[model samples]
Target: MNKILIVSQQGLARSTLKTALYGEHIVIEAGSAAEAMARAQEYRPHLIVLDMDMGGENSAEICMTFKEHDATSYIPLILLSEQGQKDDIINGLHAGADDYITKPIDPIELLARIDTHLRTKEYFADLEKSDLLMLFELIDIISVTRNPKKILDIIVEKVSCYTEVSRCSIINIDIDGNLAVVASNDLKKNQKITLDLKNYPEIENALITKRPVVLEDLGSNPLMAAVKDKIKHIVNESIVVVPIIKKQNVIGTFFLRTVSTLKGDRAERMNKLCQIVANISGNALENAVLFETLQSNKNMLENLAIRDSLTGLYNHQYFYARFEEEFSRAERYASPLSCMFIDIDDFKKVNDTYGHIAGDLAIRKISLMLNQLLRKSDIAARYGGDEFVLILPSVDQAQARSLAERVMTMVREVSVPQLYGQRITVSIGLATYVNKNYTSYEELLHYADAAMYRAKSAGKDSIFVTG
Candidate 1:
């Protein structure tokens, strides 16, 4: 509830003023300037009503004292003057009284004026609370995610939801001065669009000035004249562009467009909020950029560790790790698992006739073929020079044989440009673990390898199977 203080020398006047504000406010009364000051300091009232009819003391001087004092300066003061006391009202106003009421006070007018000031104060308080809440939420988002794009997208979405704008976007400017929409509430996921700087003069101005630029009217604003005709069909009524600065440089902008014209406190509140958000965004974007760089480098290093650099397939170590996991899963589920060992026939001949580079090219081509033919559940990796391994889960002997024949057919069709139209073939050994006595993945792989040598002894291009 709001608090009101009434100061008047006459006890009757104080009672009258108290009655006027009764029930709606917590009213305190004092009969002298000194007592009023003491009561005001104690109560910290939202408003003060001072009757200028103090017989001896200077009421205007008292109002000025209250206005000048740091503790009471923010309190709204209403001066009550006798009828036709124009000089007194003028003096009270000049002494920093917020409003005036001529004697024979009307209760309705008193309530209306007081309510106006209170409402204005409340509006500003709510705006402050909202701004703090938004900043807290943005900080939370930054702490939880390392993906810069995800962070930018969430920021734009939250801003749009809070501000109720027609469109809200985060634009990034590259070192070459190229502008792109990095994240926007209006766009699809992962969608990005390049922008022509000339079309967005407000954003350009904000960048150039390293400050905010607001276009209240798109049609009449001089900054938007170049694109007025181009955007005639757009429904946006205003635009606000705030530069995101980092270490004295403009990295990007927060671009907002509204369908309704913002005026008075609405406009001021929006501009203030945008400026604050831009400030927070500067630091948030910097952290996100750094985090993204580190994350990218970490991923690249991990990829190198687990992948074969030459053929882009799983390396020997990764294959063994995955094979053991798959084998355990198949054993636990009582599911069939097939292992295949493949040796390229006469691979050394290609290297001798052409070069090692040609041999590497042939290996890459075969790897690509294997990748294309394998199911999502199948795993293929280059085991060593001229050798490849495969793991097919839930595949029995018949299915394994069918897959081996398919691989043989594809190998015959493979042609390396470096080989000068020389066709390549592979000898594949297939083993199924359903009825085999193998106790470990290594035993299964060894059996497949031994079967591959038997196929080699039988002929160069063939398939050998063992349980």
Candidate 2:
């Protein structure tokens, strides 16, 4: 509904205006120019009605003040004066009144003029919003990138900048009814935020029924009486929640909150726009999810070709390819690079005593430990049977030796239940590149392997470092 502020010192005229506008609009009555100006700033009414005889000397100043201020300048003002005051009408227009009506109050003429101003304001607002929502570039990017979260972040940020709302958020609702805030204008400040719809009955009901929810006057709505106190932090006066659905499934919701109330045609237009946005958002999210699934499948197929079947670690062939890449990068950067060749101590004896199943279990356990103890830049691979290799970039001889010792200790302490009472241990050989002594990557691997043989011969379960 459009808001109209009536500034009239005469009680009879104020009451008459209220009676005419009451059901069609929300009317704010002010007895003086000071009160009217205060209400204009606070409520930001759509149209302001000023009485020329209302506030003595400050009356004309108030009209000029509203016109000059950014917040109130767009609001159309109509001056009310005595019938024969030609000079007063001219003065009111000069002070920035959009239109003037001479009184003894013609109700029909006043109502008609108010209707014209309100329609004009609504039309302009629609045009501005339409321009804001026409984001062809964003839609095209979402189609090309398959990164929905990035697009959603852009959507939330742009929507907040363009809209009249205080806050805008896109929430993802899971199958079990858990709400996760996927994208929002405040994501950087509040990470991984979630809300329980069970606490917000209005929203919960909307989701259940698959419809849009609007709290036009949140503070005064009796339906929200039970949760009103709790909602004060959530919304100052109004909010709208539109569901985003995919393939007949309600996946998420778009939320908008406001400090001032929205009603009637304004609320209706917002609802329509939100529905269109929700549809676009829902389709984008679905495409993102589908793309992620397809990518995961593709990655799994590639991994099967280059990963150890038992441990799911990179196989020897893939490890050799990665080693060349890392070696070249380290040489160019003149960075410290280290390699470790690890062998399971007496693994043949364990397999003969316990069976092949126990051997596989032990291998899997050690592979997991390698992953857990290593940094993201460090690469670990299952190099053929009962052996593993590690590429530790930016690690020197001392650091490599220390890491090898830690791994040896950890492997010794591991007790595989499948191997019964037998404890598992590993012997490691470490090699570092001080000044690229090895001409080829094969020479580096051979040096690490020779050191591993020395560790095994030196009564196993120990680390041997070599250059």
Candidate 3:
């Protein structure tokens, strides 16, 4: 059962409605808008029917006043009049009438309109509840995924469709007062209104303040007026900008607007849905920040694990693992390949005179020199203190020796800035497997190691190879 106030001055219209709605509802009759307003405040009716032709002088003005009134604003209003033109109906609708019922109103049609509007109001209420539930689910999803951009994408996609909005954009402000266009939906991307936040100071202020900024019309809002004028072709009608807030700090902004004025429950839903997106987006941003911090630490640890601390080349373990891969590849393809072992000659004498710091610098210098001289196919690794190794594929012993000699000469010529006058010599051992001659990659490395020691034993600053 519902409470309804009917404002029909015509005796005929009043009698018919009262009898029709007698059993189902508490029906109150008011002869004019003044009486209707009085009765509405006193009774708090859920519905009001206002006659356009005889609604206390100016029916349109009365309708507006009724809507503006705090007591009757929430109650749905029905406008009845003889003027049933499309413009008249539109004006009535625009004047805060929930529905427009013309003169000589059909009892069945009139009742149906009432039923329909009431049913719609109930549906909107249900939609609100469902939206709240969906919003909670959205928050959970955002919290778990920890991806702000992805969450924004979902927000624009799901929420805009639910609310049937034209487009959506989320603008994030950085510390320097500049803003970045962080995320937008598919519909938003093609939108001509490119909200390049960099140019808008008002949006920045709104974002910084963590407030909801709604521009019912760009032409009216002073802040948007100037920017709107510049890009008037793109920005027209209503625009809603909700600040993304978290922990009492303004992180960013979520923008929702349309080329046309968004009206009724959809308008309320749009504004609220934008706020909801802002709330969850803020959380997602926090998680994303924390996630990036953790990933940075993890990446640092991974780099340390695989890289030599001194020379920053691949460590011995990493080298061996990659060597097995490259060797297997070469063996399968029967491609020519080469491996070279290098040891700094009289490294102790240099370390003793120049100190450990200088020894570290020397290792780094040699590593850089070798890296610069080697081909992209070659992999260089620090085997141990003052020792390095290289795995080169598709090369014969002749080519390997030539590359080794070139590297050795380059190392000798490079001026170690700190050890200006001191000469740093190096001994090298080179081996190659042009065909699948070796049993495995390990045998090739073993042969290279023996050759390196031979070079060291024969004489310092010399090259050795196993036939």
TM-scores for all candidates? 0.38, 0.38, 0.37
Query: What is the RMSD, in Å, between candidate 2 and the native fold over all Cα?
Result: 29.7
TM-score of 3: 0.37
Give me the displacement of residue 412 in model 3, in angstroms.
0.5
lDDT of 2 at 182: 71
Q: Scored by CA lDDT, what does every candidate get?
A: 0.77, 0.74, 0.70
Relative to the true structure, candidate 3 has a C-alpha RMSD (angstroms) of 30.7
Tell me the TM-score of model 1.
Answer: 0.38
Residue 231 in model 2: shift from native, Å? 58
Error of 1 at 320 (Å): 1.3
lDDT of 1 by residue, 300-332 (tens): 657657877667678888999999999999889
Clashes (backbone N, CA, C under 3 Å), per candidate, total 0, 2, 2
Question: CA shift at 273, candidate 1, in angstroms?
Answer: 57
Error of 2 at 356 (Å): 0.8
Flag clash pairs in model 3.
Answer: 336-394, 336-395
Worst 10 residues of 1 by lDDT: 248-257
Write one digit per residue (lDDT tens) for candidate 3, span 321-369: 9899998888889887788999999887776565443555678778888
